[model samples]
Target: MLMGSCKSLKKVNTVSIRTTKPRKISPEAQNLYKRLQETTKKGYAFGHQDATAYGIGWKNDGTLFKTDVHEITGQHPAVHGFDIGHLELEWEYNLDTVPFALIQDQIKKIHQKGGIVTVSWHASNPISGEDSWNRRGKPIKKLLPGRRLHRTYKTWLATIASFFNDIKDDQGRPIPIIFRPFHEMNKPWFWWGKGKCSADEYKMLWRETVDLLTHEFSVDQLLFAYSPDAFDNREAYLEYYPGDDVVDILGMDLYQHWTAKSFSKNLNDGLKVIAQLGKEKQKLYALTESGLEKVRISDWWTKVIDQQLAHSGITWALFWRNARKSHHFVSYPGHKSATDFMHLAQKDYVLFLDDIVPIEVSSEAQ
Candidate 1:
């Protein structure tokens, strides 16, 4: 579905392209990256992390959501989000947690069915053994080079690297994943955030993690994403950036933080910085995580979300999981915003699972 020439501009899936050859990413990732670059300008894909196993009306209950996306909007999300934190720690799989076995199955299905997969890690603090938000003191330093917990951290990476390695398709070729770690690093809530580590220290931590996963562990079917919280300007966004070599995707996580007027302005301003910087560095950009709790605003999907996306040039925007009734991002069937959400889903520029081209894996790889 890719066509055109350099002089007239390249086209993929009938859309104009602006893709760069990836140096460190896998061929599968490179393929998706190119499509995303072209798709953002021509159309934006809708992503909802953990859309099948759970949602607002459900929570890993025995009954799974069946054709609900089609029931609500006649399509499935283009991207599915999953987490491997608990799996890395060897925890049992449950409603709120994921198991390595189940994760691989889910990813394999996504690839086979012509959808994308993005994974995030909410790793616990190695030092304190607390949750990701444990801000006891400089926990990140322990995980860096020559630190007290460095060995343990390496073991942890080995576990994660194994999971990444284990994900394979029917043809046996490794499936590509948009691996986002230490997300919202600019925020102070997480242990790896600005308040817990220096800019240079954070960069080292990021590089070390990538090095361990890519080189030491020899896991290659991954695209690294460096994402931070919302910022007012480019300086703040790039303050703790690792570097161009270690990052393939420039992503931002922003939630509703102001009145309609100021929220849109702040979001657009931050997006402008990311979009411009991503272009300069020849990297893909995405709204890694977004949405208002409960989706109170009736037209939030179209007016608030889609309006900013219209000009942001982001490859995709993924709303957080629909955990339960009280805390949710996407509207379920019968919700007040259900109709509006479908409207956002049905936009001409909005691409869902049915809109994307299916991935083809060679039988030799099996």
Candidate 2:
């Protein structure tokens, strides 16, 4: 019992030592952080993962920019999510088969329209040479500074940094990105999950990644978000937290895996935890990834998601990708939940691209 108390006190001191400010951030990124902080007071932004790259049955062939969210409600999501899986291998396309060039183009377009872009990386395992889900061995230790895969991992980060550095605007200014890497670390499926590595190792991995991108590579137009899967308590949620200085956003990825009652209870509970932590740390919070698969519950948007977020103090809520009939999150035009989703979109507290005021930065800053 005494040892546990001592460790807890140490963690508290670590948290207190760090500041909430982003490290070496660009001017536009600073503006974005301020805007998101202020916008949270009014309402939470709505986000969709890979919304413009592809949809239920169509892929953007570099000609038209469309999303199921816009098709249903005539408004785009305020936040847009993209992934850079397989980027470490210097692949031309991500694991989702979306071209890297397309992702960059879409990011520029989103930034031009004053929408937020959040990116996640599902990097392949360096030890086993397998995909991210391969948890055959403890790879985190090997990916660290002195191990055999350390050089390989640094090369991967270099590629990622180059990609981030290339995502600039019309005037050649770096666009701000909410970079979410090693997400859902509380879950066991991924290689970097709870049982795969010790909490200290995870924290080190996060800190080193941020340090490399910000200080080593000079990619500063980023706001790092540390997101874990749902948890029953605050201790479990924060067990793998890197630090406030490294993380700009405190987020959780939740999904309605069971009954709506259970989902609502869990959402409410999780939001309370982050909200309190955000206040203590002076950091932004968000529902980083969430959805009810297939929209099986017709009123899920209005009754479950929106209801939970209604004064939840979250900065944004991002639904997962819209892949196909059996594997989609948001409602399409003719789906059963489409009308209910539209109703949710119309809420005064729900923000879409049309509802948000465009963030303006000086040309000199650019």
Candidate 3:
């Protein structure tokens, strides 16, 4: 399917691809990075978190692949976001109760359909054995090399590595993923967040994790993304950055926590910071996670979200999931914002699944 579709689209130039850890990545991963960079030149892609595993009033029963976005727009998102929160504990199901096996299946399907996949890790707190939000202690240092919890952290990473390695196409090629771990680190809610660990400690944690997965575990089908919560300025956003060589994508997770006006301002400011940094570092960037919960405002999608993202240069903007009645992000069929969302989907600058043309890579490039 990908090969047949590619004949109609321009082929991705694989020469001198600019990805972090280039030597350690697979050919497919390198091509994906190049393809994403090419995509940003045209427009930013639309993404939805956990779109297929479950959605408003429905969950994947290991049978059909469905999403509220698809049900409304008649297409899936260009990018699919999934969380591996509980996979660190060897749990069959993630913290959101989506099965790991099911997540793998959905990832493969999305890739086969020429959509992108980005995975975030809400890893459990190693120090307290609690959820990812547990800030009981400074666990970053302990999770470093030769520390008390280092072995345990390695085991968790091994589990994650295995899961990533298992995401293969029907032809047995590994699917490239934008691996986003310890996201929103500018906030203090998670154990690895700002106040819980020093910036150096956080950088070490990131570098070590990348090293372990790329060199130690030989999991090469990944492009690491560094995302922080909304920040006041560029300096604040880069406080805990590992380095250019360890991060392929620079991202931010800002939502409509308050007024739409404030959300728009923050979105613009955050995108400016990343756009500058991405240009300087030659890396891709995205609004890794976002959206107003419930999408109460009818014109929020077009007036607010799309307006901010116009020529933003970010690769994609992923809305959060549609969990239940009061907790959804995107609109459903009968919701107030559904029509506006449809209009947003129709916009030329916004790339949905149907709008994207798969970039063709020659076997030699792979």
| C-alpha lDDT score of every prediction, in listed order | 0.76, 0.86, 0.85
Which candidate leads the pack in lDDT? 2
Name the weakest run of 10 consecutive residues (lDDT summed) in model 2: 1-10
lDDT of 2 by residue, 1-366 (tens): 000011221343233211222466678887788878767877999999999998888989988779999999999999999999998999999988999999999999988888999999998988777889999899987877677887888899999999999998989988989999999999999999989988877887786787678777888889888899889999989999877667789999999999999988988999999999988888889999999999999988888887899889899999999989999999998999999999999998899997776534443332
TM-score of every model?
Answer: 0.88, 0.92, 0.92
Range of the 10 consecutive residues with the lowest summed lDDT in candidate 1: 1-10
Candidate 3 residue-wise lDDT, 17-98, digit = tens: 1122433668888888878877887799999999998887888888987889988889789999999998999999999999
In the range 27-49, model 1's lDDT, one tens digit per residue, is: 66667666666667667788887
lDDT of 3: 0.85
Task: Please list the residue runs of candidate 3 whose C-alpha ends up more than 4 Å from where it truly belongs after superposition.
Answer: 1-23
Relative to the unseen true structure, what is the C-alpha lDDT of residue 23 in candidate 3, on a scale of 0 to 100? 34
- The parts of candidate 1 lying over 4 Å away from their true place are 1-24, 59-68, 358-366
